[model samples]
Each structure stands twice: as structure tokens, then as C-alpha cells.
Target chain A: MRYLVPLLLSTLVWWILTEAAQAWVVGVPVILVSTWVAVRLQDTDSGSAPTHRLNWFAVPRFALFFLWQSLQAGLDVAKRTLKPVPDINPGTLYYYTSIPHGTARYFFGAIVGLFPGTLCTEFSEDTDQLVLHVLDTDVDIALDCRRLEREIERLFKLPAADQQGRPA
Target chain B: MNLAFDIVLGLALLLTALGVFSSKDLFRAVVMFIAFGLLLALVWVRLDAPDLALAEAAIGAGLTGVLMIDAVAHLSANTLQNDQRDDQYDHSPKRPLWLPVISCVGLFVLLLGAIRFRPEASVSLPDMVRDNIAESGVEHPITAVLLNFRSYDTLLEIAVLLVAVVVAMALKPAAEDRVHQPPPAHDPILHGLTARLLPAMLLVGMYVLWAGSYMPGGAFQGGAILAAALVFLQLAGFAVDRYAASLLRLGLALGFLVFLTVAVSVMIGGRPFLTYPEGFAGQLIFFIEAMLTLSIGLILFSLFSQNPPHSGAVGHQGANHDQ
Candidate 1:
């Protein structure tokens, strides 16, 4: 029963790829065998703490915001490049984040990657400090990182980074 | 309008290629080479070869760039900046360069001759393919040519890829640099993103594979996309188990196995080897592609595992998610 979801999904994938209903004679068996193989191939630890517990509602909202931000950033960067006297001051700085270590941190990095002014060069393992290279030092990039951090927290339902382990 | 676009893209491609080879720094060369690949993909697109373009952008520009960058990172760690100083000081006698230069020139002239003569004889090939493409089990000319008209080439290609993977696996997996600290397991945002993205990536990968019968994608493109997604998951810190590694090896070999089995099985039915029974060619090819897509995806992703399959490579949440 635990394997049902992946099985169904893999079957759907197989059907989409094969696309011959009449060929079910061979397709069904092949699909089943392959799906069984896939199930066996997955890491056993995958199901222990699946990421689906996140608040689903914030995802689309975040995606829309991110896409718009990306467009704006791309245009801004393009403008900076083509201008005769480019008003840009590039510098690297550290952003201390509260996003949890595992996927959340990775997600945050990915998000930061798309933003206009900042590119994340590295994240410290010892501390939650993200090294960011920014196009403009004048911009309140720290505040912006914090704002994104808050949105991620809302989306992931994480406790505040500073307030971790605090009881409700 | 389009002419200007073509001229610019062509210039960019040439310049980027020149930059890649001429750059003294290995890192700079790798980056420039990736740029060249991307520009080449654009040229493929301008030439109306979308299938080739897709493969170029995905495998050529994308995966190749990642692979080269990985190689550069490892190489740079112990790299000597001696090349710069050596270039300025020790000038060895420039002998033995003429033979290689002459051979390269001869090869170039030979290619130019081929291009000059191609138009006279090449026109019939497409017409000939189009005339009998219906019986070839696919709507797209490239797919038909790949799977039916010239299946031996495809079979041999799959065998070669299998050999490459086996050879790579024989190498000791690179020691991971991220042995510092294990990230906490309950990263809610990462989990959420993975859960959302994985399904979509799988869907797109399968869609590309399915659409290949009539469209601009096939096993290779779909397989690359799926492999990238799987690698992304691993890089995000999913602990793949040992049993899963063996299971994946089976999956990795599945494509060649199925291709060979079908090829041999068809011979038992009195047809030539790899020539599917007339009525069942489409089904058989579709089946083979489904298997090929899975096998290719897993094999390509496994190439990036940097760990022995028996141990099941662990994905540590490194500083960079894109890694």
C-alpha cells in the first residue's frame, strides 16, 4: 500500500511514454516490471519525513512572485550592462539566514540565485551564513534577504530561526 | 531581420570557441566552452533542427558544462600557475608541429570538398526517407531513421554508453569535499520545493519521450532531463540506500538488455535481426524507448554520483544547492 502512489505515478509515466492502448499486452507488463524496479531503486529513507507537510497555498503565490522578480532582475541587469556609465557597485557580503539546513536552505539559495542584485556564492556549514555577491552595495540587500526568508518560513511553516526550540 | 540574428550568433559561436582554447586559465576556458556550446545550440535552432538543438542545449550545453566545471574545480584545487611563467621562459624548439598542422589542413580541405559535393547526391535521401516513413513506425523522420531505418546504429550506441558507464564506475569515486557537517533533516522549504519540482520534472521528461514519435524530443533529451532532476534530489541530501544502488544498476542496464532481447527475439520470428514484425514495429519501438529512457536517465545521473554504487552515495546538503 505504501508503494501505491509511486506505482500509480510511474504507470502514468509509462502510459504517457508508450501511448499505445492496444499495445497494453506488452506495455502493462513492461511498465509494471519497470515501476517495481524503480520502487526498489528509491532510497528507503525517502518516506520518513516527506516534504509535503509544507503549506501548499503559499507555493503558487511564491512562484508568481519569484517569476515577476526574475523578469525585473533580468531587465535591470541588462540595463546595467548596456549603459555607458553603469551605476553598479559589486561587493560580496554575508547573509545570516534562519532557513533550516536540509532542503529549505537549498531552496533559499535557489531563490536567491534568481534575484536581480544578489548571487549566492556560498553558504557556511558551521553557521547559517550565506555569502552573497551583490551588484549594488547601496541597496538594502540584507532587508530583502530577510523578507525572502520570512516568506520561506511562512511557506515551510518553520519556526523563526532565532526562536528555534521555543515552546508554543 | 533573421540574417542579422544569424550573423551575430555565428560570430558569437566562433568567438566563444576561440576564447575557450586560447584562454590561459582552465576555469576561464571551461566557462567559455560552455558559452560556445550554448551558442551552437542557438545555431542549431536557427537551422530548424529543433531535435538537435534540444540535445545540444541539454546534453551539450547543460550537462557537459556541469561536467567540465566539476572537472575544473577538482583540477584547480592542486593546479600550478606554472603555465604562465613557463610560456614566457622555456621555449622548446617548435619542431614536429608541421605534420599535425598539415594533417589538420588536409582534414579541413576534405570536409570542405564533402560540403561542396553534398548537394548533388544528398537531395534524394530525405525524399527516400519520406516515401517509406509510414512503415518505419514513427511520424518524425529523425525518430524513424533512429529506431527503425538504422536501428543497428542506435543499438551500437546504447552498447557504447553502457561501456562508458562501466568504465567510469571502475574509477575510484572522487572524495567529496563536503565532509564538514550533516545538514538537519527537517528542512521544510527544501522538502516542499522537492516535492513540487520532482513530479513536474518527471512529467516533462516523460512527455518529451512520448512526444518523440511525432515531435522534436526523444530518449536522449528526456533521459538527460530526468537524470538532472534525480541528481538534483541527491545533491539536496536524499540518502539513497545500498539495495537501491543494485536496483539502479539493473535499471541502468535495462535499455541495452531490452534492445538486445528484442533484436534477438525478432530473429526467432524469421525477420532479420532488429527488423521488427511489420504490424508490431511501433509498439516494440515504443516499449524499447520507454526502457531506454529510464536506463539512460539513471546511467547519466549515476555518472555524477561520485560514490561507489554499492555504498549508495549520500547527498549532503552542501553550501550550494545547485552543486
Candidate 2:
């Protein structure tokens, strides 16, 4: 039912947005059949589907944080670019992941990559480490790692680890 | 206010382009290039091409950004020395200044001559569709052109999209399988904002899509917006796996199927191929546009995701420090 609502909502929104009213009789059936086909395809490929746990109340705060961070990062990049000579020292660094779940880990990698000067190269399962290449190795690498770790951890509600493991 | 805004936007565009061209870091260059697309969309809007503006925002800025980033990601994984070599290459080459100056002068002369020699007027195409506009069904001229006048072009374009997808699939590396790792759970504040913004964005996107028939938007713009909103949701830690793939496939096929079905139905109804009966054109046009939007959005997102085969559910891990 939870999934059904979003699906219906998206379908309806898609229908209306496309102004499919004239062809609604035809379009509705198309959308439904296609949507169903899509669902079956997902089931076959990924095996498990994501369940939406609606926490409607928490949305606005996250958006504000994202906006603020994006703005800050944008400014930082602009400043670095305007310098007389680019002060960048490129290097690759490996960081370990604390997020256990696959979904959480992917989200973290994407968010960190969103920032300027960082590109995540690979995630290794054998050693449980993430490889990131950075343009400015002179910048505080550990600090950036901690910032990303905290942000992602907070977003996913993952278990906290100290230098060892403990609740923060 | 407008002037100030324009100045800022212009500067942003210049900076973005300069960043794209001048940056020694390839990844940074890719990111800047994406930013340049966004800035270019703004420029399009300022130039009073809202249709182009919307398309630029969705396909140009959004989709292209995804593709470039994916390409960069792929490149980074395979080579370390290549980056160093590229840096060296940037400094080693310069096409002589006089060559670019001569080319620019030559282009200017050709454009001026072409403009000067152009005919003052030209005959418009036969208005066979004017008396039949109401009967032809679609109201918008461009839509009419697309579905009724030049449907073969539209069909071929869809074929092109399919071909591009297949080509990309074939070219993608076999070992590059990985899913984006979820961000660590962030503060409640961040999550709250994302949730609030998503529905509103979706709402606006729908409005753009629906309003396209009468106003500046249609499916392509609307669908791109919708896709972007979904991408944002994905980034925000919204667990949204249920219909992503299937929805994508359906979206891709929707336009081609509907257009074909309707064209065939018309034939069954005793009209020529691609002919719409009286009062059915607008609806049919709407149908095609909607499907096209979905297809475009899906194709673009898939292009951006650029997932390689056989990587098999690898989670997006953190930045790997080791090159």
C-alpha cells in the first residue's frame, strides 16, 4: 500500500502533467500496463524492492541542509578557481566505510562526490575501503572524511563507531 | 534587478566555462562542465526561448551532467597515469594564435555574405492542415508538425535514441558494476527539508508538464523535471527502488508504442497512416508528448547512470584514496 500510493501518485502526476486528459482513456491503460511491466522488470533484476517509510516531518530540514552545503561548496570552488595560480595537489586516498547497508553506502559516495575536488574511484568489498581521488591533497583530508562520515551517518541513521565502536 | 541578475548570471557562465576549459583536474573539469550546462539553461531563458530553456535544463544540463560524470567515474577507475598525461598535454599544445584569428575572420565573412545574399521572402508551405486543424486534432503547430506533418522524423528520432542506448550499452565496460552507496544518515534537519521539497518539486514538475499543451512546457520539460526530482530523492536517502528500472523501460517505450498504435488505429479506421480523425489531434499529440517526456527522462537518466554490466550490486563506497 505504501508503494502503491507513490506509484499512483506518480502515475497520476505524470498523466496530468502530460495533459493526457484527451487520451486519458487510452493513456491510462498504457501507463498502467507499462508501470506493471516496469515493476516486473525491477523484481527480476534487483530481487528486492525498497520500502518507503514515510517520515513526512523530517523533509524540510534535510533540504535546508543540502542547500546550505551546496551553496558553501559552490563558493569554495569559486574562491579556489580565482586564485592567481591554482593551488591544487592531486592525490588518491583510501577511506574505510562505516555504513553497512548497500543503499547507505551508495548514497554516501554520491553525496561526497557532489562536493568540489573529490572523485570516488572504487569501493572494495574485500578490504571494505573506498578509494577517492582528490585534487587538493594539501587540504585536510581527515577533516573532509569526518565531515562526510558524519553527514552520511546522520542521514542514514547508521550505528555510530568511535575510533573504536560506540554510540555517539 | 534584472540587469544585476543578468550580470551575475553572465559571470557565472563565463566562470563555469573557464573552469571547464582551464582546470587541470579532469574530474573538476567534468563537474564544472555540468555547472556550465545549468548556467547555459539560464542564458537560454534570458534569451526568451523558454521551450529551449526547459529542454536545456532537463536534457542539456541535467542529462549531460550525468553522462559526463559517469564517464569521468569510469575513466578514474581505469587509469591513474592518464590523468597526469592529460595535464602534461594541456600545456604542450597551442594552435598558433593567427590560425584561430584567420578562422574567426573567415567565419565572419561567410556569415555576413550569407545574410546579405538571403532572399527577402519565401513561400510558406501549403496550409492543407489549416482548414483541417480542428479536424486534425492537435492544436499546437509544432506538435502538428511532429505527429501529422513530419512523423517520420519523430519515428526516426526514437530509433536514434534506441540506437544510442544500445551503442552505449555495448561500449560500457564489463567490470564497472556498482550502485551508489547511501550517505550516512544525516541530521534530522536535512532529511526534513528534503522530504518537504520533493513533493513540491514534483507538483511543480506536473504543473509544467500539464501546462505545456497551452503554455511553455510539455512532456520533455516536465519529464526531465520529474526525473530530476526523483534523482534528488535518490540522493536524499529516499529508498526508491520499487519501479526505477521498469518505470524507466516503460517510459522509454511509451512514446514509440503509442505513436505506432495510434497510427495503426487510424489505418483501421479507414484514414491514411498517421492521419487523425476529426477532434482527435490534440489528444493524440498530448499522448505522444507525454510518452516522449517519459522516454527522454528515462533515456537521459540511464545515460547518466551509465551502469556497467556484471559489476553486480556493488554498493557506492566512499572515495577510494588509492589510485
| TM-score (0 to 1) for chain B of model 2 | 0.71
**Model 1: per-residue Cα lDDT over B8-70, one tens digit each:** 889889899999867766667777888888889889989999999988988898888777666
Off by over 4 Å in 1: A1-53, A58-83, A90-134, A139-168, B80-93, B117-119, B170-196, B233-245, B302-323
Which candidate wins on TM-score? Answer: 1
RMSD of each: 6.7, 9.4
Please provide TM-scores, in order, for all candidate models, with all chains considered together. 0.73, 0.57
Worst lDDT 10-window in candidate 1 chain B: B311-320
Per-prediction DockQ scores? Answer: 0.17, 0.08
- Which candidate leads the pack in lDDT? 1
Chain A TM-scores, per candidate, are 0.69, 0.69
Worst 10 residues of 2 chain A by lDDT: A45-54
Worst 10 residues of 1 chain A by lDDT: A44-53
TM-score of chain A of 1: 0.69
Worst 10 residues of 2 chain B by lDDT: B309-318
Steric clashes per prediction: 2, 62
